[model samples]
Target: MASTICYCLWFSYVTILHLVSSLAKSDNYIIHMDLSAMPKPFTNYHSWYLSTLSSALDNTDLDTNNLNSASSRLIYTYTNVMNGFSASLSLAELEALKSSAGYISSMPDLPIKLDTTHSPQFLGLNHRTGAWPAAKFGQDVIIGVVDTGLWPESKSFKDDGMTEIPSRWKGQCVNSIGFNSSLCNKKLIGARFFNKGYRAENPNITIVNSARDDTDGHGTHTSSTAAGSRVDGVSFFGYAPGSATGVAPRARVAMYKAVWYDHAVASDVIAAIDSAISDGVDVLSLSLGYDNVPLYEDPVALATFAAMEKGIFVSTSAGNDGPDKPLHNGTPWVTTVAAGTLDRELRGTLKLGNGVSITGLSVYLGNFSSSHFPITFMGLCNNDTELTTKAKGKIVVCENFIYSSILIQEAEAVGAVFISNDSDSSFGHMFPSIIIDSMNGDIVKAYIKKNSDSTASMSFKTTALGTKPAPSVDSYSSRGPSKTCPFVLKPDITAPGTLILAAWPEKLQVDVDNYGNVTLFNSFNIVSGTSMACPHIAGVGALLKGARPDWSPAAIRSAIMTTSDIFDNTGRFIKDVGEGYKRATPLALGAGHVNPNRALFPGLVYDAGVQDYVNLLCALNFTQKNITAITRFSSFNCSSPSLDLNYPSFIAYFHANDSSSRRVQEFQRTVTNVGVGQTTYVARVTPIKGFRVSVIPNKLVFKEKNEKLSYKLRIEDARMTRENEVAFGYLTWRDMKHVVRSPIVATTLKLES
Candidate 1:
């Protein structure tokens, strides 16, 4: 009874503390001012946005200088995509602005919570690591990366021994704070920034706008991964120590700073895309996006479609909201990339007082004594609890429900152990701690509860190299069956995104430990995300562009997707690390892990031009007016329905009730011969369990290069499963030397029809 009462009191104290903390934060002085209503219909987005902001500021009684600096005071404005402006203003000031004009709803810009090397060989791009590819190293191609910004001073951006800049490049460097024209060398040909939206979104914070200068390491890391110059001895504290080079090391980078402090405003990103397209970049690399929205409503998708029409390839991240999360901005025109793991892992171990040692994972670089110490739970270490002294030098076990780092810090424990719901192989903690799985965590908790002198020892290990069964889909890499466009498969391919070692901005790569110890590295660090994967494919796209100068964006995308390998190094089918180590499906890994060498020589490509995409837009249920607005075409006639987009992969969507259990779906596709002439490829369909799939005119014979052949794919499903059931298969076009593959997925999603 005493224990129960004590537990109740402790829980009550925590609940009250949390409530008080929330109230304290809610009562803070600075307030989030939001302009909710979208302005009246306007043709020009920028003009209307600037005018609305000016009018809002005009209502204020500030001096001329303050009024003129309204852009600086603004946080973020929603112009083209949605509507609204978020800023840091007092309640009265916000109300004044809202009452002024063109304001509806008011809210805060709530803080949204925000891989490389051996990957080259893993993707069969071993030749790119050296000079074997010769002039094919993306020589004249320019890759425009839209992200945080660039770090010009990194050795990877040096223009040493670089050739003359491409004549087609019409870009220039913008001078902002620390950024200068000198940073734009032959290698990094252009640098620009869009921050009006950022400033409008973050008026309370005085952030430096250094043009394309990257304060956070995200932009620098991605840009370097896409086209960094070859640098020897690049690594993060001796880990991954070796020569570091991008897939297209010689590709020129045009930096566009659209993301600010990890959050990108839709208007700012669209502006950046427009500028990049106008600047004549051969390829655009975007490592940022948000939740999935309709393609027509997505500014990024609309801009990218425009870019595709202009012959520039756009590669975007598949997003990090993982396991089975829907992909973001996963339009058919853009190359959506997913994250995959490499052959490297960093492991650590925990020794319990029961003389049992369990392996946990971590990348913590600090060293501690090997002796075991008494352990306790955070509940016992509460402020008024009797375990404060017991937790002083002991390792404390904390539930992963809250931030383990904060709990450990507050517990005053020498070391900490966090109970996680993730897999045992999961390991990303950076402190002197071990994140054990819940099962083992419970065991540790029980051991500690059974005896008052429970203790454990923790130790770190050197980076494990060639850690086998590699090239698996990263669990966090966003999955797809595109929420907006379910007929198309997203994440065109996966790339080495986990534990990737790449360039890091020196200024932002510093870490301070619990002992007031500061650790700094000069060049590179390990990071993981589909953001990392996007650049690998973008760099590959640059290489393909440099080689096949006449290849359309669709042709390049087709080449990469159709040629990607679905197997890992161990000759086993690649696993989706996100889906509990199950065999990866087409939805998890798209076409598979990107294979650069195979892509370079892909015999046949399912090609779709601008008109083809426009035809796809016509298939959607939008009115002709809406379609014209989306495609920027005045007279677009409706084409066939969704599945006939001539995509490299095939997907069939269905939603069947008990009355509509049996259904048939058909798709038409056209493939162009980019390979040797006089090649005959035969189609072979791998049957799905519950569906009958057939391809008409299975033999495709190409008499000459660039010849086109059309075929029909039909899927008949007879089984009635639960609603929204998804099944997968594949179709392979095989020749003597080439095997062009495409995934076939059937989904019982009625809306997809």
Candidate 2:
């Protein structure tokens, strides 16, 4: 009987495996078409696409006349972003499409991943002063956020002081299950979702029909951080209590739901960008990215180029894989942001039996007895049965911080002490818990080993403001010297991304207390990532747009970069928490932490337009076909290709052995005066080691506000070392009242003999 049961089970497993293999044979792919090469007979691109798809399908019965049957295989038909469509097709079908007319290229649909909250005062944004009043609090500036869905009931979305929706906005509030058009007021002008790709991939799984309702809380948090209205008396479980306001409080918000529960498909993201561009958003904020790929193949990069052509400013997060990793969304057109620390800390104290009190960070609010509990050391606290047996009624110490309080709670432990190497301090633990650095952790572990009755107790959480050496580059923020495009400096700027307080979905529970009760303030939560930092720049971009409606996207980016602050509040050079708290390099902090007030009147700005990007693509050695795929244009010239793309920062690559001969490279840049009338600007270069830098015509005299001036920067390598190394400096163009600074980086590569 047991043998017969085994045979039946084996048969069932084999049948299921065969079924899965059959389903996997057909995969999703994004097909790019050359619009210029479209057959003259086919007037409508949609009908042409249908005919083209039907020709490729194995089933001849699938024709354009049978619209339902033909459309069933299509995922998304992109128009504004790219001339393409995403569909599920077999290898045979893909080959047929390649052989058909107007096909540019095709790539298998890849998965994307999500990569904010902060004090407005930390960024020098105040209601009545500085850039806030000058820009009228970003009045009527529409910020389109493409991420997870949103929570309509959050107080941050209330249209208390908002004006009517902008007449230029052509977006609509899409109604779905749990969400309707009525939820979108003047503050939230539009909400839409693109999930056909996701649904096509996971055919059996059920997803919420509502695109406006956020369940994971990521979208709500990011959207609110960029343009949320002010909500007074906000806190996260009574921690960091204050009025929470987005960087641009009065700017309108429009959400495009592309990221779902786990991951986002590239096709869906492209569709979202297409919709945002067609809907007329002034600024686009995307807090998600995938691995680094070439510009020609990156869907986000391609779509953003189109948005830039339409005069829309794009802000994207540098990926979360940081400390030392290649950054994603490295396109020159978008304002890529890196994560930094805020001046706030959630403080918690851990008291030992020997009277040694160590203060760390936590967001724990559960009550703990004053009496110290017996302490025990667990390597990682990963084994559940062992923990339940040995850690009952005691304080458990862990070597790693990832073990949640639920594990300790399930083990019946009174509290937990996590020792971590990371500087993160935003975790909310249900049980009384605290996270300390590895050095402090050693002290606790040693104390437990020495005494027979070692015990420890944790205090409640407290908020600490004005922490020193803030605005430091976070250890988790991605770094630069982009491998894909080494000529351009990535992560254009850094902003407050750690311990940011913002609106959250009220229904989502953060954590539960000792008695299994939810202890979180449902309306708000603190999150950290490059994701949070991206929206800060997006909000700043909106403020710039509101203040100077005539400024292009590149002008806004240049202003933000040139007028950034390299020094922290303590008047010390900003540091990097990643490299043992060393002075941050341009690769880590970009131009430096963003300063909205200084960015408002940057005196002079470096501006680049669609033609400039086309030239850049040509300089990158991309073929005409590849350029057409990315730019959606049929004709482009590579005759005057130059690596110097007139960017905000300068980066020069050299060989280490070239020291014998002084290798000199020159870069040309043009700046337009945006400040007061008749300004004389002088150039000054911070001397870099092993290099001599000079600027021709060091003095630039602008006769009028709109006058444009050009200059050439020449760098000569003097004493290049044998090892691969990097040197950093700055080129500052200063008038009497304004300083326009750009970072200069020189990298030396070792050559083989």
Candidate 3:
């Protein structure tokens, strides 16, 4: 799982100089400058950037009153991810810096956003039998979370009944405000904060009072979802009141607070990755998504690549920007996770006077009756001033998700119901409110239309288990065609992310009352996004790591992907909730919903090494100079075809001259026998309707463990009947007990006029 080479054409010295000179008139720009070569590992490469900038901009002196101030003007320099520095500087300053001999090309520093977990029983990992106890519950693995911050005092981070921290752990819990060495035990092993990039972006902002304490509950939720301690009687006001345990409850966590309320800067994220890698984390879980850029250029991706090179597995969120734009977290080297539904849903039902009951999702702690009052529209209240007088003491209906709190508290409404266009019904307002989807909202609206007095009583029920037809891809979960790398399938796997009840910080506020009281709930919360999904897989990766200490990052990923299930609990193919209830494709669900039990014992895995990506760079036509810059190894050469990288998943793209030409594509794949020795597996294909697929040497025999064998898959497409067509299928190698599945996709571009 080394850096998956993102190749681009090389820019000549004159072209770079010309581009830099043209930027002299700009006021401010955020640029990522690539270095001519990677700096020495574990060294302060910031000094290299400082020296280069100082020499290039000899006419101007830096204002170095403090490191933060200096970073604000000069910007923070990154080393571990790539030997480059990101800076906020003037056009003239950038031009002067471009004169340095070490400069490569500079690109815009894209802004990123938070992409923002679940029942282990649903995935069946609670038993002592099977691979559950064999994994030792991932007690030896360390999961590093790069998110908002951590709340060390939470019960989830407690270290009761745990062994000492692993001696391989090299990280430390910095004694920041609130976060101290005492708070970091065997469970919560490390804690650190990064904000120089945030401060550089926001000049006047300061995070003074609380350091490393999760003012926002995102970090605590994700971290705990991955490897929180097993705590009994954990609940959010009696909702999900059971023994709360993470996917890997015994695994230790190292918290890296990289995101701020204002921004999750690329520079800060890269720095956190650098520290986490140096700190020797076993698995890195990042819930943030950078802007849509080439995979090689993304700072986080590059840093994660370096981490992967060190045998650390990395899992990232697929992003919540979905339904239409799902091509996020497209890097093939890291495990990109998509959010899926769970078997349990917290449902709230409204019993109407007309003998109709409607159910939706909500975490409402208490139930109340509003049958005596007539339900009326809140006059489309967008703010408190917009609340109508007639709406007082009534079950007011609001159109938007944001205005319910105002209508409930300030307007004195007896209850509030949000008529939402979105399908997700999970509500967390500090009021007796339930959001009804459009279909049910229409039913409620029609009852009001037929009767003058529309009366309804609301009651919140206990968690509903065995939710039929569950594990659907969340509507908001990003879909994927891999815009950056179309040949690669994105969102490497799916996990339970929707309405996941996990640990939450009591200090964070999701809502407030009109009386100036901040509403805070302790212990647990239900949050949805790929952010939650990522940690689930990270925890699973830790479990796999604990089970197989010698497995590479690629092997871990291959195990998860190959052993996953594409069908839901109902035995039908999983469906994407956002795709109009249509059957899910590999583009949406990746290899499919993760099967933790099966992943622990994947029989065969497609193993890839650092040089595999170097060959891909060669196929992409990257210059030898750029290759040396990224690999840091002089005299490096790419010797293999890009499509022959021995990846677990395969994609074949066919080019046609008018949809009439016969097109054939070839893909080579190799798998290592990780299961039993002296076993033979046969290749099988679930061919697409319009494609003819054949696998040469369909049967593979392995005499020893860790033995590698290769096979070639050839696909021939029939006459393309449509423009810009895509066909989905899968190729599997089956031995008797294990199904090594790989998703196969073929696409044809639209003919140009």
Candidate 4:
């Protein structure tokens, strides 16, 4: 009964400036044991580049533009001290590699660092929000960050204050690869790896391990956010920072490092997808996506579709695709999210007192008469359109457009009074005087539009006081119903994917008080990104998993979506995809933001399981024909009419279609009574006339949590007509009446005599 919410985040960084992450000692399981009887992990050691270079390079570097490159050459091919060879490499070997390369010098340092100072953002998002009402302090959840590699021993993943990796992760990573008791127990972290294709030479290769040794840092942040147990309450990090941890705290992780590199080749992703299903992960969160070819192109999509068939809920970011040029992956099975900023009690405001005030009214050459003020910036006060003072003895009014520096200098120059501005560039800090939103400015503009006279008085008092960050949609979150795409909805829902405070590398903690600061060195730094928000969904997925281990991925996704809250904390519809624009579609926030509480008991959920998806592919001939693997349940070329997709599906209509199509497919599911509608509703399946489907317990009743219900469906029919097309729509049950649908869940058919 104890479950919590957590998330990873997405972020953009100038890699060049921040890549110099410090190096930490590697945690080598083999370091302590003797290896005298076996060969070293590598022979004639050389990274891929070095090995390739030896075969190509010949002459040493000569004078290139008379540049002194000797010193630079000695530091070539740098690897993080956290890498495999960093600590082991002797100075001689390091120097030799450095001397070998001419153009290249030291290898780029990982752009991560340690900041022990916890950020206020964490409290604002997790602790104060009550988003994780059940999450407790010190309790741990072993959430897996299944991505490319984790480089567990890297500088950023260390335990010391120098960087800020969690002690739980470090403690477990020391002796085992993943899910180990001593190292990976309690609050431990683990990883795995997987490959998509067979070895090219033999066309037969078995991927032994998919342990994460991160080539990218994405996996690191994601895992941390999903189940990072708190160091101390006030220094909280993940949403599930306590005992009744993430959806499933007692749940161990199965990190299947399956990344379909290279813009995503379908066949490859499928392998990982299949592996995850086989691994039986409770919940899967994918912070990746693609643009084209429906949600079925690359293997990731296929595998994701496959995993759903196996009941693995998948979640992903809505892509950074924005208003102008958008792209996203919005499959019904996947839950997407768009970003939204938080607006707290504190907001940025500007006020000007005696130090700043408007003297009087005057029209500049720019607006009143473009001729004299064709020049936008200079020549204001005197020659443009100076106005005489009126009543109240207040400062004079003037047109806004004076440069900020000019306004400050002008206010002082015109010792007569102070100044005010309406339209400027940045936020409140753009000018020295008081500032208001353009809407406030429009009030003045609207009055001017009506009267065109300066006699109307608009008085105001200024008292600027507080300054704090409010949550609103981030300016960079992507919008959806992707461009060049019409059917798919994107960014299913958004979470707190921004600069957040969490556990950091312990070594980095030292730098805190070194400069004399309130150093809670026990904690690490603060950060953000969609990568952070991902775990929130993942953790929720885990909670759902704890309830129904056999639920299909689609069902889980449906549970999360159907339960989503259409409103925010203030009871307002969360609008704006992110930044400052509308996405122009419902897909921008598919099912709205996740409502985990509702998800705990969604009234009804759409089902998409691996078997169902695979069967769907078989129906469409998308799956490869497996002669030996084919069973009696499987069918070959069937005669079914080509689909007329002008309807709801997103395929093109064509001739030469199978008129007689019959296949054996199944979708079995169970729904629980989650709402308080105590009335027992009658059961009814619609499209009552088309295709054929039989249900069990035709009518049933439910009362509480430990509810019970059952149903079985078998399809038998063969026809090709408009009726078939209509049936391809969704099948629903309303009170007692209902409708039948195709593409999986309807009683099937084959063109028969």
Candidate 5:
């Protein structure tokens, strides 16, 4: 009887707890307000927000004078990015906010994911001459890195040769439990963090303090890649051993910690960006993004637009969801970069008993016996029970790469082999392992089938440089044909993002040898992703900014895009590693792989200002109110609407089965001469089979530098026979020393009439 009574009380307590949880169902929402509509009597926007929140609660007795009273609900008050605040609101509270004055729009705070590095010599950067000396190796330029914070003690952040901090810098190193202001120096100028939105979303998470120190190696790697100091004799477990330096070694770095762990709240990211803008960073590098959303709705897009208007160049990653559509960061103002393979490879070889040698990729530093071991195939190795039974005392061959290296070790396997199509095989396994392509994997499988006993031996990792057909589009790098705005080609350029060695947190272990011992070089790590590609562009942009301080953000982007390389080091068209090694199109490579040296002196640039982007939004049917919400403009007229954005590339869309005899589209563009002296540029168009492209007046003659000229391109598609087909070509404007090229993409669609 006593036990029954106790059980009844326990049940009643759980029932009451459930009721309270249901009553307090709330979510975080970012609320945008009209700064122009604020009451005249209120001078502080925070006070106004407090009163608004109190009014929304219908609490007449609450004190609006005390700002800290609303700290539990108020997540962040954004000032620079937008006139807004993020708060934890319930369904009924959100409805009340909608009816409140000055309220414009509200969106639920979403989650964003974090998306690295290489030798400067691979991109033709020389220390004594060329871009390095011309740009002073990006001295005194500030690059704001927004990601998972950074490791302040890394050798790549040493300021031994750095000059004094730039006078324009106004940022500070926020003090927390583990990090302090004194940790910052001349090289790493500032550090800050935003976690209010994160804490609000995860109410149960215990945050010690708001510290901007990198725990995950991503932020440190990316920050170091953009503008890290030079470190001699750096390597990742004895692979790629040599001196390591970022693209721009002397550029000052500032850390804005927005992400926590593997993901970040959009509201926090916006807050970080807002602070960066006010802090006067010359360039913003964000290696994080979310799913493709409308420009007006995406907080990162809105914040980046504000940054662009402030003359800050923003470089973002083209995501890692590759060989797929609808990648993020499609905004024209931001330079979206994609991942590509470097000329370097960490190579390993597998020798089968049948006298067949297959070359593959691996970062394993372990050694195996020269004697061959019996190998058996275990499809995928996802099931522990199956692996335990079939994988004991033998080398296991799996059909795909799995993240759980512990499973293979626990199954008592001598070694493991993965057959994967991914171009990035930089993962260093805890055991002896190597990843081979599917075609070579089939050969091993056939060898096993033909012989009763299949034996194989693997070699240790070795550094190999100057691999042919490099700068190929990586298989994991996101592809384009921007879903939101296809007129502007996405993935503005490509850079080295595969098997890159960059600085890492020393406490982290990324590689292990055969004996399950951590590798020695913990200060650097090998990683790959478009996250790595974005900073390469950021570093290059800093170089350009330092060389040409008068150039606008648009001009810098135009130079990078217009002067990129369409061919590989071998003088062949760049190929897409994801598409069965086919020739990459504009949709895959944008203008092409970034040629930093060539970009330094692009003869002509297609420039666009804020008004041009506004015109683009107008062409896309954005309302005046929507424009105000995004741009913070009080009054403006959508007087001109045109799809022609004066971009560096041209894309014309057509219907696959339009019965009309002729389908013609025209685009107008203006180019400004940026070369040394007066010169004339002649236009040349590469012919496409199904389309005819003509440039009006076919030549642009500029008498002086900075002179502007206008031209119109007319493309006529006579027969659109294939459905969903794309034709690629180029339009080049050549002078004595510069070849300003633009990719011409003509895509056929099945449009509903």
Candidate 6:
């Protein structure tokens, strides 16, 4: 009885704490402010618990003290705004709200909960590391996925959390909706064509009823990788698993169909960007760009620049033409994400020479199943670098790293029976690829070297295989240092952009799958790409922006870059990304993979703001020649280049002078956080074993909450004037009297003369 009473008291206390917000939503949908405390919203997760807050509003048994002490409580509500809306933001309302007493103090950064899993056409790459560290819950930052309209009811994409379509996108009424095919009916969604950038009053576009409709299904998959909620054990594939979710999930999404009928033009893309900005989206992730495309001088390039100027962080695909000439859209300006393979083993095995002799492991070259032909294991190649040999009537087992397509054409054509590929990135091991049981290739080599003769006499065995069924980075997604524009490192970074599943048309699924015997959890799929990673980054951006509402775009980027994880599975620095020649190999991380928690407390950040971008565009002179690019859906505005995409502070940077090439100059970001209370703390710098960090001032102080502090960090060493190098280092503090902490860097720098 005592225990029961205590439980009841606890329940009452928890419920009472949310009393204020309880009154706002009669439904049990409650929202907690603390990033750590917030629970994921489920189609069925909050149905019952929500009553506690709402019940009090009706009755008067609520305890005011509990409500007062609760950090923050908000009624969760979603409204469809696809079609045009009559509501207007009055200037008076804005002024009054800004003037409101507690407004400034209470404001937080915008959220980054993008819906990455909207399409089903991803490669299902499961990249779940080197991302922001939170409870792993999705965030609530709004993203404008200007692609196909979302069909919330499809069985393949049933679990999508879309509440309703937007009002502004209430396209021409349609009758049917679908998922598999392009257009099932018109009334289901609101789709308006904003394509074919022309010099006319209205562009050649049409409006049709749709449910976030998609034709190619690419956009749908991309969006899913960004924000699809967890349904199965963890995630479909992309990063942000467990308690750590996408940057935003509770945030709104504005979907636009840009590449309808498998076509995309500068006008269409520009219109989409303009439309997104007008809709007030926080970030824009577009995984589309072309080679030999125009520069900031071109409409497409200029459009991208404009978006950045508006304080919006634009993430584009680095382009697919890798290991080839004329780079893809791997420009340094955009947050271009590239693809890399993940494996458990450093070496693999192949059957060369005889019909039945298992000598040792070789690198994977493709075939794994149905080995009807004779096979033998070859010995380990050196350093697991390159493998060579002659296999006539036998099979060759190659480690992943080498695209099977090449081996398929070469070996098979020369009388080789079959091939085996070893890769382990969850689902990325499709086709002939084999998984290398958690052990690395080095281990396999060591084992072979230890038992050289025994293995040489052994025959091929299927038992010595590995598998993980999760997706991995696609070899064909795209590469950076864009061929067309090598000066700019095409893809700035990589994120989860692959085979993803999101909200699909309800009418498309025959019978959606459910968890156990329930109908609550619906919709899910696998995916891959920079598209996937873009939303992941965007979500982290939202979280950090929320924590430090005043940070500029550049600052956010800097936080993500500097504090990113910069090591490979082997704990070594990722190698040169194929193209773009830097006197030195640029770190795989232009800054590094994003670290949201670290970003929240990053001692320094490069601040990119809208004004900074304006200056960049002004000097570069990237202006539009036509006005019809904007949608009729929005009230058009024409002004100087100052009003382009609110470029974040970081996007404002330009190459230093005296060089024809637009090379980036050196810059640094410094931060000091109160990891503790009032007095000062000791500072230290211990970089990752293989990396180095240069800390300026070397030591600093951290104040308590409600108190602000500052520090001075030098850019380069006083002894030498390095022309174009960023001064990198770590800043640490321990046993401080006040809040003090150094940030997390992915690597330790090796001193070089």
lDDT of each: 0.74, 0.83, 0.74, 0.37, 0.81, 0.38
Q: Quick one: how many clashes does candidate 2 have?
A: 1
Instruction: Tell me which of candidates 2 and 6 scores higher on TM-score.
Output: 2
Better of 3 and 5 by TM-score: 5
Name every residue pair that clashes in candidate 3.
none
Compared with the true structure, what per-residue lDDT tens digits does model 6 show for residues 203-263? 4555333435444455554554454444343322222222222344433444566665556
RMSD (Cα, Å) for all candidates, in order, is 24.3, 28.5, 28.3, 27.5, 29.1, 21.1
| Model 2 ranges with Cα > 4 A deviation | 1-118, 354-356, 376-392, 397-413, 419-421, 438-452, 511-521, 658-662, 749-753
Clashing pairs in 5: 116-531, 116-532
Q: Using lDDT, rank the candidates from best to worst.
A: 2, 5, 3, 1, 6, 4
Give the runs in model 1 whose Cα sits over 4 Å from its true position. Answer: 1-116, 128-135, 199-207, 351-359, 372-391, 396-405, 417-430, 435-456, 509-522, 637-643, 750-753
Weakest 10 consecutive residues of candidate 4 by summed lDDT: 365-374
Model 5 per-residue lDDT at 15? 99
Reference-based TM-score of each model: 0.77, 0.79, 0.78, 0.46, 0.80, 0.50
**Model 5 ranges off by over 4 Å:** 1-117, 353-358, 365-367, 377-390, 402-410, 438-454, 509-521, 660-662, 750-753
Error of 2 at 84 (Å): 63
lDDT of 2 by residue, 232-325 (tens): 8777776787788898889999999988884889899999999999999999999998775778888788899999999999999998887667
| RMSD in angstroms between candidate 2 and the native structure over all alpha carbons | 28.5
Highest lDDT model number: 2
| TM accuracy, model 3 | 0.78
What would the per-residue lDDT of candidate 1 be over residues 239-357, giving only the tens digit for each residue?
Answer: 45667788888899998898877778878888999999899999999998768577777877878988999999889999988965688967889999998887765556676776545
Pick by TM-score: 4 or 6, better one = 6
Give the residue spans of candidate 3 off by over 4 A.
1-118, 209-211, 365-367, 376-393, 396-423, 436-450, 511-518, 623-629, 655-662, 749-753
